[model samples]
Target: MRGHRPALRTPRVRTRGAAIAAFVALAPLIPSAAAAVGAQEITVKLPYDCALPPGPQRVAVRVAATFPDRVAAGEAIRPTGVTTTVELPAGAVSDLTALKATTVVPETGLALDVAQRGAKAQALWRGTGPARPVAVPAEGSLTLRTTGDAPAVTAVVNGDLTLTATDLGVDLALGTADGAPATPASLSLTCTLAKDADGHGLLATVPVGPSATPAPSGSPSPSDSAAPGSGRPTAPASPTAPGTPKGPTTPATPTERAKGRTGHAPKVGDARAGSSADRPPAPPCVKKNPTDKSLNAYITGYANVRKLSGASLIPVSCVQIEQGDPEIAFPPDGSIHLLQKSDAYLDYQGRKQTPPFKSTFLTFGFAPTTATMVLEQAGPMTVASDVLLVFPDNIAETYVRAPLVLRVLDVEVNGTRLDVGPSCRTQTPLSSPEPDPATYPGPHLVMLGKGQLINGTDATGYVLTSGGPLTGEVTIPAFTGCGAGGEDLDRLLTASISGPGNYVKQIQGQTCAVGVEVPTEGQCTEDRQPYVVPKPER
Candidate 1:
């Protein structure tokens, strides 16, 4: 049903004798695997009857826009690269000439209907005049080519974004041959679709699918982030999948929706507040505008502190200053060594929640007490990847180090809140690699990741653009700087959470496209969004 549709939908046009003719006419427009590559281009031309100052004149309105055939639900529907052309009758020039004008400037507005999930809204697509004012031609009709950014839409449910072009309005300003404003007050004209008795003025339809979320561990989605891990360019946008589509859509998680950050596109280089997204070691300076092939990264990892027997979910985002060259390898062995040029970003040290735990310290005797903690990013996370050749052995390994410090908010002795003080924190930052017992105050947090094929992404490694699971072990250093009024609870804090051999795991979603590029959609509908972080590790 997602492919070619049954002919019954258009019985009136497809008679038995005309079957071959129809096939011939539609052969070039068939949707194929190739068409599913990126954003597709569409043009709609229609005739309109305008209410001109000199009376009604029939004209043509042609609209060109770029759109993806399919989009995940709750994702931004950016109808980019749009331009509109309106043909004007000679009478338009005559009216302007009557005002002693030699040239005319115009602005246009196109009103169309957008329907999704049984709801319809009229959208006014604006248009601006060409760079130069139109020179008044002494003869027949003059044409005005204009462009504008269509107001974007966000689809929350599965369905088709059906657009129907209907009414249009144009405002004109006249100028004399001397270049002075002849009619600065401006003259306006309106028009309506002449032959849209049915749905002939329908522009285009984009199907919206569901949110993309990976299954835990062994259970993976059909395609997590169909991104090519090797950083290959995504294919060109293809035609809409042909069929009597039954409201294209996928479901969104309720919990994600509750957070208010799920189901929308995050801005390029957008990092979560207080997560080192805007720290010193920033990733490669982002260009004013990134090219189509460029990509960014975001990840969430589960960390289990062995000393505390508690876990925390860490959210991180990154950008690539330089793409890892596939043709070249670091240490030219049979396997390719991909030196990825990307860096992890977390901004200000965001205070995050951690599980509550009970600890037994010698000083506290046999008393059972629980400490509630908040974990914060110490600094920017530095990340890179290890890639193997796609030919013989297929493996994309990821590596990154996170600097972090934990602070205890409150401690309850048998349900009694203990004044651990605001400054109760570890003396040194947590380290992810194997720690040296002799070195008591060193800080670090690192993760080792394994790549998963983002189906249809054509990529084979855990490049910045691709995503997968990363795991690691860490050592929580000893506690220091505790207590208020010199109550010094350093020993209590260290006994409760400071130690080593902690475990961590995380899944990074595929990078989303920014600039003039198509989105890198894997199986995740909303999985690629850095804004919608997953639930914490329980």
Candidate 2:
């Protein structure tokens, strides 16, 4: 049997027949050249949403601007191309319906050209000359079908969009398709110097007209305020037409000048605080009804000062006092006192800390027991007082305690009992040595001086609306702080404190009978005058 098997053949496997394939020769690929030196691209996101009916829609026409990094003064910087893309929401398809679309080309340094895409060619250009509006054909109004899922449609503007780079930055408004003035957004192009990899900077310059003369060396150069050695490049002068008159420069206002005087406190009685006669008439005080009672008052503002020993600025936080308790009582004599039950908290680094931290019973106390209020007919009702900010422990722990004195002045209540403007003055008195054991029971007290302290002047603008809430801005000037050993600190801290926004106090109810007696009509009028009420007879 084995011998007979030798003649057995291997099994044959049948396979499906294959079809013949055709081939064509293709061209070789070509690589593009690298971009030019100093070229940069900036892409901005344009987000838009529109409500549309059940159909396709075009919501926005997208555009892009390409220009040089820097342009010479008085020279035009034209966009390389203005590509427009008609955009639609997601999940939308074009219906091939004829509609109309329009957009105004900006009048700037560049020109534009419109180029159609395919043979379907439903869109038609409908504009005559320069400065004319552009119109295109569409199936439906952009305002209608624009409500649903649609994709972006792209086309090229067939005209010039140009602007002269006369200033540092040029702003272009984005218009709507209907030729309506719609500024969905704006584009800003800034001309800035280009820096090389080696840290060298390059700037472009345009020649002044031939009539123009080089500015005198002693006189301030147009770029004087600019960084040294970073002046605009000089170029050959161009011919200037005759009859071009140079305009006179306008002078800066006092307010403008005051900005330069940062860190310096304004004089106590500056023009801002005009004399009573010169001030505008105060708003009429809506007389409170017989049952109306005095409302509780709270002080809300900001505290900004340097750290005990640092050049960097400290974080800005809010300063607030809870209201009620030793109700802000304005005695008949116009004396204000607050043995406040609510604690004053300083929001420091997001942590709520009481002043004179670590010391129990030691709190912010107004000395002299009361503050005098000066009611003004034409201006604010001024409340002035001395605040004692006790810093019981020195940073180095060498000194037992330090006290900083600040004078706070508030003015102007346009409505109800709101005071929106205030000025503060802070000064460091000579630091006193450790207190004698008998005089100072618990710990030794020392004074903190200039190079060894934290202090500054704050200009605050506060708004106290009716129903007991406050808000304001606190601007602190450059301030110095000292090191533990009384060494000069490095940097000065300056900051602006904004808000807790929700800073508020509950208004405690009271009958007209309690506390200060309601002022009579005559008394109210008298209080409006600048005179203070004499202390009541004992």
Q: How high is the CA lDDT of each candidate model?
A: 0.49, 0.20
Q: 390, model 2: CA deviation in Å?
A: 23
As a whole number from 0 to 100, the lDDT of residue 107 in candidate 1 is: 60
lDDT of 1 by residue, 43-89 (tens): 77788987665457788888888877677644556678888898887
Q: How displaced is residue 515 in candidate 2, in Å?
A: 48
**Model 2 lDDT-worst window of ten:** 14-23
Instruction: List, residue by residue over 1-538, the lDDT tens digit for candidate 2.
Output: 0111211111110000000000000000122132223322322212223222342222443323344433322222323433323333332212111111133222111111111111011110111112333332243332111011111112111111121111111122233554444432222222221222111221112121122345666643332111111333232112212332111111122223222222111222212211211111121112222222222221111121111100111111122222223234456775443322222233233433211110000001100011111111111121111112223211111111212222223211111222222323222211223334454332111311111111332212111111111211122222233122443321211122111121111111010111224321111222222100111000
The 10 consecutive residues of candidate 1 with the worst lDDT sum are: 17-26
TM-score of 1: 0.39
Report the C-alpha displacement of residue 515, candidate 1, in angstroms: 4.0
Question: Model 1 residue 240 lDDT?
Answer: 24
| Candidate 2 lDDT | 0.20
Supply candidate 2's per-residue lDDT for 117.
12
